[model samples]
Target: MSEALALFASSWFFVAALLAVLSDAFLPLVPSGTLVIAATLHLSDTHTSPFLLGIGVALASFSGDLLLLKFARRGAAWAQRRLERKPGAASAAAHLLAALETKRARTIVVARFVPGGRTVLDLAVGTTDRPPRRFLRWSAVSSAVWATYIVGLGFLNEHTFDTTWLSFAVSCLAATAISAVIARVVQRQRRLARETEAVEPVTVS
Candidate 1:
């Protein structure tokens, strides 16, 4: 590895990344994306390997998924009771359930990329009785793709800019823009799904 790469490749950063991702599972406000962007910028400037960066992110994310899954498994009944008491939670759960019916793996993967979407989906998955093996299988793919694509975006921005700070600014702006777009798209899809549901006729046996 190059000197620049070696400088940031310490166990400390790897641990930090792991912890941030793990916490972000429950805390949607965590700056995991910022951390990944900063790490990628460092490697890009030094002309070193970013493969390990990708690995660190993906594994940490997977760990978070497992943690939430376990929590959901244990507290599903209690959570459901509470969710049913809250109108917002009930609506979110209904939308999540509807999405699951349309596409399970793809929904998981898409949500992983959207801001705050992962937390909702994680809780949804846990609240439902999705098998561990199936959830793991889909989560593995989602985590891997999210890490690679997001980090790759950082690399792209760095290559386009002359300074690390400049790239970081551009990348953060782009992330915000993407998140807004994703939120809008999700809202539209949910609206359409709800409308479709409302119009469907009920039949008597």
Candidate 2:
């Protein structure tokens, strides 16, 4: 792991950041915050500009988000069909499809902070037929904020690995918890909307 980190850090911080961002789209196992921190550390050692590193990471992350969103829009049915081919996967797939159909906006916005949820959110938004422009605008803003927070943490504590790791872990946990809360709120709002529509009186013309 250290060797991989060294190789990534040695080549170019921008490349490392780009790869990290891309990996997040499909593989949540990749620790984006860890890569950002590692890149920051390497840049600091080489006297590279931290601001540029941050920008590179932000752009790369946004690109990944955009790609996932496009895939979600164009490939959802294909993906579902493929998933359905696998025995015992139907139940999970059905639940995911339902979630994608409902609470798309909330899922996308909240999943920006969750590890695996980012790609899922993008696909959900796409499958639900949410406007691309609106989703992209919000996604860009969210990615910027998320990147800034992680990068800022690295910048502040450049020398302490223990402190940085702890901070990153806490941040991830907090983000996940917040996402759960948002999902609940969105579900409640949808239920209320349905109830309201059901109760409205119809006027005969």
**Which candidate wins on lDDT?**
1
TM-score for each model: 0.84, 0.63
Provide the lowest-lDDT 10-residue window in model 2.
Answer: 88-97
Off by over 4 Å in 2: 1-9, 81-109, 159-205
What does candidate 1's lDDT look like per residue over 24-88, in tens digits?
A: 98787898887787778877444557788888889989989888878877999865765576556
What global local distance difference test value does model 1 have?
0.79
lDDT of 2: 0.64
Off by over 4 Å in 1: 1-14, 44-48, 81-87, 200-205
In candidate 2, list every pair of residues with a backbone clash: none
**Inter-residue clash pairs, candidate 1:** none
Error of 2 at 90 (Å): 10
* TM accuracy, model 2: 0.63
Local accuracy by lDDT, each model? 0.79, 0.64
